[model samples]
Target: MICYIYDGSFDGLLTAVYESYYMQEKPEQILRKEHFLPDFFIEPIYIKTSKEKAYKVYNAIKDKVSHEALKYVFYVFLSELKESSTLIYRYLKIAFKIGKDINLHMHNGIVLSVHKISNKVTNEVHRMLGFIRFKFLASNLYYAAMEPDHNILQLIMPHFSKRFSSQNFIIHDRKREIAALYNKEKWVIVDMLKADGEKLFLNNNDEVYEKLWKQYFSSITIENRKNRKLQKSYMPERYWKFLTEML
Candidate 1:
């Protein structure tokens, strides 16, 4: 058995897929080099990322498969699952063989796994859209922090960018130490350290707004009608840390 290691980028995974065919070595597993654990029984091969090779494989998937299939591959990669790389490889192998009809083959385990994982990423993207709470910063920037289960920071950028098009904002993913910064017209993702993030100060009036909002939330709640279970079902306890009312 052989294992192929990549740099953990989406392009790197595609490049590995390209090499697997050209090198004629069928790997038993494809893993990111940063997370790879040595296997005594498996021979390891390190695959370098190539934009040209990655582009060719990417185009092949879009042309040979469907545009929707291409989306599945991307979302599955963003899932950051330990076996995501291998799952993508197996998925495309079948995808290329069967073409766009691969989506209908839910009976196949590999196909089912890909769909399930991709759906999970999509679901989180939807949830984050409503869950994100922004606070005004001292610099007139809107800042919010979250620690989602998946690497979904990039996926949610479009919604916030359009919604807050006239304002500057930053959405920080505390777990990943990454943030999306938007300046009215454009947005970009950047690496942010926890210590640096802590240096950002909230606007002086932000506390007043938070207090008023919390009070409003409390005033609207009827003690007799409160259903902790239902509330938790809609807004999971795991996300309470970042919510103003929950705080």
Candidate 2:
């Protein structure tokens, strides 16, 4: 079993997939930087981040499935489950053989698990769209920071880019130590701590948007009809960091 270890980047995972076939050996498992490996150690092959090969795999999936399906695939990739890459590898491989019905294989645990995770990522992505609080700092760049347990920032960018098309914004995932920067027109994602925190959390951009947002959030509460229990039910305190009303 060729165990492929990745550099904790989705691109690296895709590259590993390419290497899997090229190596002519089926991988027993795929893992990221922080995950534990099996007790029975196999030679761990680390795949380099190859954008070209990554796009090759991306196009393969996209050509077969709809763009929305591709998004779901990426969402599944973002799941923090231990066997995520292994499952994704299995899913994508079968996708080549079965086409769109790959998702319909609900009886298959791996496929089902990925579908469930895709929903969670999508839900979190939508929630973050409304939950994110941007601040304007010294450099006039807008920035927001979060440490989502799941990797959902990339999935949240389009929502912000569309809604705030005229403004510049940056989102940092403290858990991943990566950030996405949206210039006026386009968006680019990079490692937050790669060089400096110029456009990261506590960067050159911080304003009172958070305080204002919290104030407005508090002001809008209907005191008479406030149902603490129901509010908590709908928007649990656990997800408060990703909810404006709770922020």
* Backbone clashes under 3 angstroms, per model: 0, 4
Q: lDDT tens digits, residues 54-126, model 1?
A: 9999999999999999999999999999999999999998999999899999999999999999999999899
- lDDT value, residue 241 of candidate 2: 64
Q: What would you estimate as the lDDT of candidate 1?
A: 0.91
Regions of model 2 farther than 4 Å from truth: 36-38, 48-52, 64-69, 193-215, 241-247
* lDDT scores of the candidates, listed in order: 0.91, 0.75
lDDT for each residue of candidate 2 in 1-247, tens digit (9 for 90 to 100): 5788888778988888878778867688888867846566586777677989988988888887556557766787788777788888887787778786677778987778778888887777766666676767676677777767688877788888898889887887767788889988999888887335443444444446667877986888778988889977655466676554464
Q: How far is candidate 2 from the true structure (C-alpha RMSD, Å)?
A: 3.6
- Per-candidate TM-score against the hidden true structure: 0.96, 0.79
